[model samples]
Target: MQHFPTGQAEHKRHRRLARRNANGIYNWIMTNDVFYRKVLAHLKHDYSKLEQHARELEQANVALEQDNVDLRNALLAKEQQTAELQREIEAQTKASGACTRRWPARRNQVWSDGWNRLTNELAEAEATKYREKSKTRRRKIKALKNRVRTAVATSNSFEQWLLFVEQEKQDVETLLARYKKKLQAQNRIMTEARVLARELRRSAESTIFNSSTTVNSWCSTFERGIAHVIVAGELFSTSPATSDGSSCLRSDSELIYGMSTLEGLETARRGSPFSRSS
Candidate 1:
């Protein structure tokens, strides 16, 4: 029993030393845990700030995309408008060129037509003048032929006719003077004839004559002869009178008187002196 009490005292002293060392180790572990917790909280705050910046950048990118789409649409519209304007300008230019090309041709055509019409009118006028001149020349030729035929008829032979024609040229001048006096006489006769005709017409209207055959016949014969002489004088003024002046003598009594008087005049003309006038 004495040995057992000594062993218990030593064991109690060793247990006290081991307990103090364990207390020191526990204090060091607690301090290290507190430091680690503080470091982790700081890292978490940095990560949150990075996340917020990323979200803002995504919103800005979306806005930029929308603005790019609007700009592309505006550019397309402007290009379409420019193309339309260019086409319109080209069409107008072509039309103007075509008009310019046709103008001179149209003007020339009008001028040519006018010139042709004027030329035709001038030609027609010239032709008309030529035709009129030809008609006048034909009339003159016919008159000259009648004069030549009358000259030939008044002579006995061709040689005599030439000589007679030359002599008749002087006689014609004298005949022209005589013709003027004859014309005055004819005018007086015509006046007398007209008065006689008027008296006859009035008598015919007033008197109902049952036997007017002889008177009517004589009147017709006298008028017809007078008209014939007048017409012959007008047509052949240069021709010699008939041998006994038969063309001038109208009634039977006048024919006898004219023949006697013309024969006396011819005898006198032949018997007159052949002295030349100065």
Candidate 2:
């Protein structure tokens, strides 16, 4: 019975020790739980800060992207403008080259025309000088012929005088015939020369007139082209024949008839003078 009592006391002491150990474990667990909760709260705060920083970084990236896009667009616009300017410059250069080619051709034509005109003028002046000199020579020859005639008329005895007069008459007749023949030849030559000169002058005048008309036509055509380009339409409606009817060319028959009548009048006057002299 005393041994059983000691065993019971040992069991009671074991129960008290287990109860104290359980209480200590409960206190340590509660303290650990508080520390864990504090660690969780700190982790949550750090996560929120990281999220805010990420959002700010995203906004900054978006802004940078927008700026980059704007810069790219500006660069593209500048490139397009430069390309357009280059095209315009190329077109202008081509037009200028064409004008340069035409200028030399026009200048050469003008120079050639000027040279021809100057040559013609020089020839005409030389011909006029020759004509004036020929007229002076003819007047001098006429004076010499007149002096010879007067000397023949003045020479003095009856048979000697008669022989002298007959010889003088023969000499005068021969001289007069020679003078008349020479004068007729000279007149024929002068008339032929005058006709040739008139023909040459008329030819030169016709050439000049035609050249001037061609230049005027070219100018008018050029002006019309410019006007058409600027105003796009609205040129003259009338035909050229109708517009210039007053300046129309006459028939060749009409011209011939007029010339023939003039010739008949001239012939009549010339024959009247010859008849009166006879």
Candidate 3:
């Protein structure tokens, strides 16, 4: 077990160890180069994948922004429409309120006979105008319908039918437009009529106020004349007159002054010409 090696055997063993060490160094270098290449490749692949993901995210963000813009526009449009509808609702409500509140007062309240007659006349005029307008529209519609029927019945070919169809469409559109225009005009006229009625009411009230003021002024003047007459009567009673015996009698002007409103009273009793006109 303790025997030493010979020179030849020891030489071979040393040579084999030196060759194995050289091969190990070469193998280590090659393996390290391969590992480095694999690591570099993985790094590049990961970078490429990350870049692709970032681009996809950017595209998705762009699409989301576009969608958001469209949604905002739609929301704005809806808000605008809501505003318009609200305004229309307010206007319609006001119109209805006005129509309901004032239309009956003209009939119930008492004013000048002229005002009553004017209200009646305006109402009659409106009714007649509306009746005539409705009749005219209906007549025109009937005539148009008859014409369309005639055209349809007389058509002999497809071309003729097509022509008639086009004409019918045009006629229908024209009728619709006419109806629309008439309805618009009717609403406008109704609004104008309400305004006119309100104006008339105001004017009537003004007239009554002015009449009352005039009546007050006339009463003041009459009262002053009466005072003066009483003073004159006292003076006449205290003074000595000639033998004419005219002190007990009033003059025509005095009598007329005392009853200054007799004619108006009689006229009121007889009914005014204005009330009679209705």
CA RMSD of each candidate after superposition: 27.7, 47.0, 51.1
**What is the C-alpha lDDT profile of model 3 across 155-232, one tens digit per residue?**
656678788788867766765665565455445544543443344344444545565553444444344434444543
Q: Which candidate, 1 or 3, would have the higher TM-score against the true structure?
A: 3
TM-score per prediction, in order, is 0.23, 0.25, 0.26
Predicted structure 3, TM vs. truth: 0.26
* Candidate numbers sorted by TM-score from highest down: 3, 2, 1
Query: Which digits, one per residue and each the tens of the lDDT, describe model 1 over residues 1-278?
Result: 11334434544544454466676544444443443454445455655665676677777777777777777787788788778878877877787788678879978988998999999999999998988998998898888888778776654577787877777776666666666765665555555555544544443444344325534543453454455445434534443354334343243433443344344334333322221111
Residue 217 accuracy (lDDT) in model 1:
42
User: Over 4 Å off in model 1, which ranges?
Assistant: 1-97, 155-278
lDDT of 2: 0.56
**Who is ahead in lDDT, 1 or 3?**
3
lDDT of each: 0.56, 0.56, 0.59
Error of 3 at 183 (Å): 99
